[model samples]
Target chain A: MSERGKPNELGEYRPLSYFQLMEVSLRELLVEKGIVSDAEVQATLEDMRARGPDAGARVVARAWVDADFKARLLENGTRACEAFGLDVPALRLVVVENTPQVHNVIVCTLCSCYPRMLLGLPPDWYKSRHYRSRVVREPRTVLQEFGLRLPEAVQLRVHDSTADMRYLVLPMRPAGTAGWSEAQLASIVTRDCMIGVAVPDTSGSE
Target chain B: MPQVAARPQYPTDHPSVPVRFAAGDRVRVRKTFPLGHIRTPFYIRGHSGVIERYCGNFPVPEELAQMRSGLPAQPLYRVRFLQREVWPDYAGRADDVIEIEIFQHWLEAVKT
Candidate 1:
């Protein structure tokens, strides 16, 4: 007998989920009406997939080395990013600084309204209901779970991206990497660091 | 004679509410439950906080979600509330806070 339903690349055939079915229906409808071509949709998806946290790391590194750029970033995140040659249209960007006295984290209680242009897509946990509800209520506890235990003396600022505005955490530069170049410094700025769940560690850097 | 400064040119047709609060101003999130794409989180309703910054005006998200022109843009601000105040049992420093972006329509000036 022929293999049932022709196994997929993973050697398994499964039905599309509800949301997947809806997305396929919508895309097909749009294509049928000539609203958008299939190629255009594919290209857009490819563009989105190509984006990563490298741009955000570069911005963070630049801010660490240049006080003026850091001030600009803190003042107007969108414009500062545009000046950096990154296209972040429509959505308003807000950069929160993590100083010695305060630690900043980002959350979207309503939904996951992240700074996608800078940091690409958000992580799975960021979109989870658990993280959304708990982070705002018990930040230190949540941070502790992420292996980021803040001292009682250090204040925590949790930003809830509830509206059109998106937030990016400007984590403090770790010491001992004093004279590192921007590219070298950026290497230490991980995606989690920009999300405020982790900080840049120089131990792994050369 | 003091020279009068010229007012900056603004589009008369632009739909925008006047900015009422500045940074450092204390305001309370309006406590109301209206349906339809409400951006204001329920946890923050009726809470008092200080304005962290004026985030300029933007089209109302609720209206936009309804496929309506969110014209006469509403002023948005980052309101900062102490975590302890937001949650009585908040497990963090007293200085810990949460900043949320709220539209002007959802905020009221704290009565002095």
Candidate 2:
């Protein structure tokens, strides 16, 4: 059995929350009705847990090195990722490139609709109401909170993922990194970089 | 016993509504709100913006939630609104903007 929600020092397990109880009931019903096997559900959960931002990082790294790939990625993100052999099934990805004049960021004002297929799951703060509400209202301030201070001249473009589309920020490649291998470049393309909250730091890569 | 059919799969290329606006066209989001699963954000309602790009068509989310065929699909566009226009006290740069994906039904063309 999973050790989730383990009891405290008293050795007594706490009751499941309302949503947790509902989830359990639903899962049980689905299994009982043969809609989905327990093994399939468990495997899916494992698959979700196994996903990480490496796929996204590699894509960014490839974009940095290959102009053709970058053009394809910018024009059709979903097709480019698929052609790259990444499993982006049914994902209508919209990639926003960041440049010297313009900076791009993403926020789902309605809810945390992130590019999970590429970047894995979203961070807790990304889902928090604080980030969701404030990011769209005052993005600079929110970005500042994340230690990303943009120059006054850089125009900020905040994307609200409100509908059938998903967004990924293509952060500008930092300077002083010449002749770097694709793997080395990908190492710096962290999850936060793709999410637009943070940029790749060259200082840590070397 | 009656025969049951498999769940219908709505193809992404299914017949959709005509695209009204194009890139660079000025448009305004409709302010009206009806009770249902609406994808349009409340903050963008009644605001004017420029069509950044046409993102193609997809099933209407409102109808999808009601267990109905959301067809024909609706044309969606990425509308770019100036931050200052959206929030009067927006502290970001004057050129700072926010873009949202809105369906055709929620947008009306803005006269120059």
The chain B TM-scores of all candidates, as shown, are: 0.86, 0.88
Q: What's model 2's overall lDDT?
A: 0.88
Model 2, A1-206: lDDT tens digits are 24445785778888777977788889889999999999999998888778899999999999999999999898889989999999887688889999999889998988899888998888899999999999999999999999999999999999999997899899888898789999999999999899888999999868
> Please, what are the lDDT tens digits per residue for candidate 1 over residues B1-112?
1122122111124468777887778899999999899999999999999988777677888999989999989877889999889899986788888999898899988866
The CA lDDT of each predicted structure is: 0.84, 0.88
- Candidate 1, which segments miss by more than 4 Å at Cα? A1-9, B1-14
Give the per-residue lDDT of model 1 (tens digit) for A148-202: 8887778888999887678889999998987899999989999899889988877
Q: Which stretches of candidate 2 lie over 4 Å from their true place?
A: A1-12, B1-11
TM-score of chain B of 1: 0.86
Q: Pick the candidate with the highest TM-score.
A: 2
